[model samples]
Target: MKLVLSPEQRHLREAVRAFLASASPLPKVRDGYDPQVYARLNGELGLSGLIIPEEHSGAGAGMSDLAVALEETGAALLPGPFLATTFAAIALTRVPDKELLTGIAEGRIAATLDGTEVSYDGSAVRGTLAQVLSGMETDVLVAPALTGDGPVMVAVELAGPGVTRTVLETLDITRGQARVVLDGAPARVLGPRPEGGILDRLCVAVAAEQLGVMRASLEAIVGYAKIRVAFGRYIGSYQGVKHKLADMHCKLEQAESIVRYAAWAADESPAELPEAAALAQAYVGRACFEVARDHLLLHGGIGYTWEHDAHLFYKRAKADEVLLGPPRNHRARLAQLLEL
Candidate 1:
């Protein structure tokens, strides 16, 4: 399949990048989630429904489109309750929940994962979850829990009765995390987990975001190298610095290709999506983390300080490296997927 992004996808990326550059500059991002920005993103940009079908108040976009948006999100390190809501929108298609689905598209609903385990006792769920992303403000929570048969999906409202929430500190302060306790909370059964590709597609989207992180870090370092002089010459002119930049660029390019293909696979090739996602996570996670870390070193003393944005990117890179699962795990899964 062609690796290049389609015209619409390119336009989407540009639009998102431009919007984020203005709306989510480093300062605003450092302040954490902005309700205004989140509203604009979902309402004006229609990002809240990028992947949700039109019938569900979305843009009728696919995973590929979402990837394009996510790349920019990563570049800007945009924060909010976006991830969990986006995931819920995509994952809820299996179940018939028009109101909740439409709420997600409208940005009125927010969902996140903490740690949740529940059983379907006919009409409700009973369980607890910890470290829910942005759970403090989320309305719905989507997580996998065990049932009589196997692992099933549960969509519960955080504001409803029999629910408890506790905000927790996280390295990525741009996004909030919390612990949620559910005591026979009312929930809707989505479906079985393994059979659904919701989590896998989520990983693909995350890979695209990490790819942006790597690209941005490389660009930052390269830009700094060109301007910062050492020993009467530009640091970038040094053979060592040049080599590191070259290697970083090479890895980013590789990451781009794999991420694009995984996005494409998510939209068009379901059978191949698991393997494609595995490959993207395995490579992109570690690749982005390395690029960010090296970029920090290349930035000299300024990067080490909290004031600079370099550390921010580095932390995001590291967090994303194991957000879903570590590269080592994905690598193992990749080998199994490829039968290697």
Candidate 2:
């Protein structure tokens, strides 16, 4: 099937790219590494309400639109809690409370999910989430906790009595991640615990962001290879280099197909989402890191330096690859899905 984007989607892509070019340029990203910047940007761009219905002050766009916007954000390496915030939006959309939804959409508050846990008592959630993007800046924490029935997502105010946050130093400088400590934090349950299709959709949304990061890393490598010469010739002209680039191109195309299918499935049919998301994550994770490493090698000594941007993409790709689930995990899931 042809996977071309519609004209409106293409326009949306262009608009987002342009917006990032001006508002979140590479230098700007380097400068604004704080989590607070993400909240401001989300409010300014109306990104906080992407998934909420129009009546709740959201854009009411589908997964495709969100994916398009994320692609540009990845390209720019714009620092903010885009992934966590977007995922939080998805969770919030399920809530029937119009006021809560509107609060999130208007950028008056920020939210992120604390999905990781080591052990939990009935009253307290205590664990360290490794890669909680924008955890420090968020005003609300949407955490998945155990209830009498099953796992449930609860929204807790960050300023509550027993919540403590610590910013963790990360390789991905553009994005912030932290460990959260919840000591009997008061929380309001958002819903009856996401399961089945809804959980799959959330996973697909994360995969889509990973795919965007991979695509951007691939392009960055390709762009660098074309200009950086070695032994009096462009490195891209060499057979080995050409083959590497070619492999990256193939992997990227495959990942794109899976990501597109996953996003569409999230908006259309949830049954197909798990397989699509798994495939996308498995392929995109490896491809993104490989491309970044290849780009660094092409830049030779300059790439290994601190001033270069290659490391930024490389680090982010590596970290994100294992965030939700590693490639091996996805592969196992895929095998089961295919009944292999």
Best by lDDT: 1
For the record, the alpha-carbon RMSD of candidate 2 to the native fold, in angstroms, is 2.6
Q: Model 2: how far is 334 from its true place, Å?
A: 1.2
Residues 274-326 of candidate 2 have per-residue lDDT tens digits of: 78777767677777677667767767798899888877777777877777677
lDDT by residue (146-259, candidate 1, tens digit) is 877788777888899888888888888787778788888888776677466866787898898898889889988989998998899999999999999999999999999999
**Candidate 1 worst ten-residue window by lDDT:** 111-120
Off by over 4 Å in 2: 34-44, 117-131, 149-151
Scored against the true structure, residue 231 in model 1 reaches a CA lDDT of 91
TM-score winner: 1
Candidate models: Cα lDDT each = 0.83, 0.73
Relative to the true structure, candidate 1 reaches a TM of 0.95
> How displaced is residue 339 in candidate 2, in Å?
1.8
